[model samples]
Target: MQIFARNLTGRTLTLSCDKSTRIESIKDQIYTADNEDGNGISPPQQRIIYGGRQLCDSRTIEDYNIQQFSTLHVTGSLSGGELVYKFIVVVFSIAFGVPILKYVYRQYVSKLIESATESIANAQKRATERVSGAGRRVTNNRLSGRFK
Candidate 1:
């Protein structure tokens, strides 16, 4: 069957492939064709896509019901290391990000509550001292009033 294959750079080519051909084999062929005589740059790994679905390396054209002249998109696939890095990033963003932010907010709120309570206690102490001082002054005046 004839298939229209396009590389990442939008270069189109027509290739002959049998329905029983594994998708992996087709990728190797394209890679080989791309490097024909080791002349041009080629990607380290590949991802084959057709009909908006990623074609599996172990699957055949017939398995995907790929028709003749169907367009296959060729692009670079992430390496194992890159995939791991991406996974780590996603995991941290979900698992650690929210909790860290919440912890910081909790710290601020706790400090605010503590400061408010301390201020209130200080004000009450001052009020008590003022009342006691006034009572002492009145008592002193009464003691001298008997002499006057």
Candidate 2:
């Protein structure tokens, strides 16, 4: 009998098998078929799912009641090496990303402080100039009245 194996990319493989065929054998056949098509997927990395259940290697095709032309979905499984690589990437991102964020925050706060200080200095200078101008006007008025 022949069953169909459908991959994540929607590619279908027509494989020849029977009820007595082991799930492991099916996986091997899938690996071969995929490699022939330049996919390079190994049997250990291939996960076969049918009827919402993952097929076990020790079970036979008949054990799962797989019918003729039944579509078995093939998905990729992450190996230990792949898992380790992903972990390293995440760790590095967090390790470097936090420091960069802190630097940017500090720079922004410094600029804000500097701008506020400059504004306060300008306000004080204006107030002092106004006070000094008033005093000079009062003194001149008093002197002119006395001379008259």
Candidate 3:
């Protein structure tokens, strides 16, 4: 699969990601993770204060299934006096749009080339026919004049 995006600078962008990914589970793992406040949350099922709200301890994320995998993407931009998350939309759009645009462009170019080739062939055919007819007419005129 292919992906495309328009960068903030109006430049072309491309990104690729595998269909399958592997992620470790939050279980049996230690996290000194800080949330921009010099604070760390560890273990699952722990209640911690976040965004000025009291939340359950479900902060630990873990993957234990040998065949299970997860994807984590992060993107942010500082604008409008706040940061906005735009990673998901960008990733999803590029993941599906690039291939489509590529296919459409290929088809369009193929059609153009076909049309040009056909036009050239027809023109060559007409020119050949005209030359042949003119040759025959000149020969006939010469023969008639000789006979007279």
Candidate 4:
């Protein structure tokens, strides 16, 4: 099984382990890959959780029902679950924000189109009136000249 492990330091590793391999050995592999200057964390001290369940050393990855490409969270210490809350909040904000922004944009475009249409119609009306008035003036001038 392929598992993606992420540490609290934001270091991640894509590890391949046999389905029968125990969680304890997986933690050892991660520890070996990034021992990094006497961090002093043993595999037992590192807490690994997957899918909301704390993984135990005695259980195999398959026994815990962990699947391929599953994320394993390894934290040196426990926080107040702030990361989970932030992820939910951001997702909801984007879901609610997109339609509102799209509606505002559509309203703005419709107003612009309406104003342009009105301006064009008014200009056409004025040009038609001017042409008709000029033709009438020319016809009257010709008639009066012939009578004189």
Candidate 5:
């Protein structure tokens, strides 16, 4: 059976597992799992290499028949129960909490800026009124002294 993994970006990768070999033999190296059963599993990180890099750990190939035509394709994925836990803790946390926190922070900063601007404008208006009043009083005193 051909193995496939679909990424978050909607990309699908086809993995080559020989039809003759039972899934159990390649469980650990090709996929991740808590149990040693032959079911397909996903690993967190895997690199695809033809010749230079070793395809899988020796333990993965123990008692498994890998024929000449049976080439293995390795993929990185989160498999089994660990994958579920990671999805709940990491993915759900970021998906829900980040946007809410960002929105609340943005609103608070905007309100604070608006309040500060209003306070500054009020202070300027009061200073201008006081200065104009003082100037008028001085001019009145000078005129009264001249009249007297």
Candidate 6:
């Protein structure tokens, strides 16, 4: 049976394959076809998607229920170096990012608490001074009135 293989550049190739054909064989054929067109894509870098599912190399076409003349979309995968770089970025973010974020959050919360405490202390001091001043004024008024 023949199936249609489409690449990212809208290039399609009719591949002759059987239901028992492994997905790896299809990838090899795709690589050869792409190389002929000067694309130079390797089999490992080629990702075949059918029915919205990625085809595994170890699986057969019939395993995924790929029908005859069905269109298989091919996409290039990320290089090993790119995958390693992404892994490193994720590891570093997890290792250092969490601690840095926690430190910043603690500092912010500490400053907020300190500011609130100072505001409350200042308010209490003002209230105490006002109450004492009022009491002193009343006492002076009473003393002055008694002397008169």
Quick one: best TM-score, which candidate? 2
Give the C-alpha miss distance for residue 115 in model 5, angstroms.
Answer: 0.6
User: Which pairs in model 2 have colliding backbones?
Assistant: none
Residue 55 in model 3: shift from native, Å? 63
Better structure of 1 and 3 per TM-score: 1
List of clashing residue pairs for candidate 1 = none
What is the TM-score of each predicted model, taking all chains together?
Answer: 0.50, 0.57, 0.26, 0.48, 0.26, 0.54
**Candidate 3, which segments miss by more than 4 Å at Cα?**
1-98, 133-148
Pairs that collide in candidate 4 are none
Between candidates 5 and 6, the one scoring higher on lDDT is 6
Clashing pairs in 6: none
Report the C-alpha lDDT of model 2 over 21-125, residue by residue, as the tens digit.
999999999888878768756888889999999999999999999999899999998667967756765676688775554565689999999999999999977
The per-residue C-alpha lDDT of model 6 at residue 6 equals: 95
Q: lDDT score, residue 94, model 5?
A: 84
Better of 3 and 6 by lDDT: 6
| Candidate 4 local lDDT, 60-107, one digit each (tens) | 988988888888998764557978866765676698865454565699
What C-alpha lDDT, on a 0 to 100 scale, does residue 133 get in candidate 5?
A: 42
How well does model 3 score by local distance difference test? 0.37
Task: Encode model 6's per-residue lDDT on 7-76: one tens digit a residue.
Answer: 9999998899999999999999988887885875688888899989889999999899999999999999
Ranking by TM-score: 2, 6, 1, 4, 3, 5
Which prediction has more favorable TM-score, 5 or 6?
6
Compose the digit string of candidate 1's lDDT tens values, residues 75-94. 88765696775676567668
> For residue 122, what is the lDDT in candidate 4?
100
